[model samples]
Target: MKKVINKPEQVVEEMLQGVVAAHPQYVKRIEGFNVLVRANGPTAKVALVSGGGSGHEPSHGGFVGRGMLDGAVAGAVFTSPTPDQVYEAVKAVDGDKGVLLIIKNYTGDVMNFEMAAEMAEADGIKVDKVVINDDVAVENSTWTTGRRGIAGTVLLHKIAGAKAETGADLTEVKRIAEKVIANVRSMGMALSPCIVPAAGKPSFTLAEDEMEIGMGIHGEPGTHRENIRSADEIASHLLEKIFADMPLQQGDEVAVLVNGLGATPLMELYVVNRKVAAVLNAKGIKTAKTFVGNYMTSLEMAGFSITLLKLDAELKALLLAPADTPAFVQF
Candidate 1:
């Protein structure tokens, strides 16, 4: 309930305004719509558009710039953006090379984004879509019919966006995105809960000494909650589950992403990363690149998710390619 804002109902609108206020050079709003597009783009290359709810910041929106998303549609907190909004985004960012939609594997997100894609195609804009289901947590969740997409979606953005930036067509870009979706695996744990502004109450409750393994970003029930463990133990547990799902061999390569769920501190994330790196080294898995920070987040949620992207040469190079965005940048 303690949020800095004018009104709960206006949070998404105001947040978008603030984002543009801070990064006008990178993004601009689609007037009257809760959609953001790259400020100076939609160039003659395959464009990327992805979105879900609004709470997962620096995600679908903060990534609107070169080498990432070309457009992002924002819904209300934890709610899916409507088809009209998504259609607007597709229209705004399509540069004649076609557009690619990177959707998380949530029921609403799948339905809405696909509806938008259909509408865009009706308008003669070529569009392709890929769904990300990288969370090794569960087969189904409150909002999704399959494994929920978590932080690994960001890696999808990076790799596919890089391919698109290379002037790849929609089909090729979508193929790369699907490859990332196939190779990436993620798991998360939460030490505390977060409050949604409109709800004015905690999304879920966790006892002080308990932690949730495989926690979903929207506070959906995870695999189970148990007594809190050390950072190393938690990291190892997450990695174990990931490896179990996608067995990595010694000498394999990967890119690591230690993502914060809004309220988790950088210090804690790094602590988790330390163990992640140690485990991968012990397994002889060469890490190509590592990113540790708040890439995708549930609003004010106190947790972290570890994502490991099994990498081949193509994926490794695309991941390391230059990207300039509000939330992510690499030279």
Candidate 2:
């Protein structure tokens, strides 16, 4: 309810304007559309476009630069972008190498992005897509038929984008994207809910000493709620669920992402990562890389999500490859 904006309906539009203004050297708009593409787009390599509702900043948009996304479409807060919007993004970033759509598993996102793919194909632009179902928390959430993609989608962006930057063909880029989707898993817990600007109300509520575990990014109901627990306990439970879904063994290479949900502090996130790191080390799992901070987020929701990406040599090298984006940059 307490948002600093002129009007609720105009939030997405104004936000996109601000983003382009702040990073003109990195991205540009599609003119009267909620689309952001690399300032130097329409390149010779395969283009990567992904999007969903707004609110999760520095996601599809923040990753729009070299070694990451080529374009990103934004909808209303927690709302899906239309197929036309997505189609325009594909057109704007389209190169001879083709375009790849990195969609999360939400129903609207899947439908809209897939529709755009078909539309592009009709025009002879080769398009392929990979739906990320990395959330290990639930099978079917309110907005998705299967697992909802959460922070793990960012890892997919990094690795797959690096592949595309190498002048890889569309088919090969998609193959590497699928490989990341197959190996990544994530789970989240929230201490508080967020308020949508239009609604002027919190999406959900929790007691002062309660937290929702396995919650989706859009405030969907999670597996269960419990009294506030220690950070170690929470991290352990989340990892327990992750391993239950995909068991890992000694000497396994992996990457860790401790993502903040809007309002969670970096200090708290590092504390949680400490526990995550201790657990992986104790188990003899080799961590190739670890990222901590607000990579993906809800709108001022007090929570965090943990993501694990099982890595091979190819994945490790690409993940650590040089990327220059607004939100994420690595050498």
Number of the top-ranking candidate, with lDDT as the measure: 2
What are the lDDT figures for the candidates, one per model? 0.92, 0.93
Query: Worst lDDT window (10 residues) for model 1?
Result: 137-146
TM-score of each: 0.98, 0.98
Tell me the spans in candidate 1 whose CA falls farther than 4 Å from its real position.
140-144
lDDT of 2 by residue, 1-331 (tens): 6778999999899999999999999999999889999999989999999999998997779999999999999988998899999999999999889999999998899999988888999999999999999999985445447899999999999999999999999999999999999999999999999988988999789999999999889888899999989999999999999998889999999999999999999999999999999999999999999999988888889999999999999999999999999999999
Model 1 over residues 52-108: C-alpha lDDT tens digits? Answer: 998999888999899989999999998889999999999999899999998998899
Total clashing pairs in model 1: 0
Positional deviation of 224 in candidate 1, in angstroms?
A: 0.5
* Superposition TM-score, candidate 2 onto the true structure: 0.98
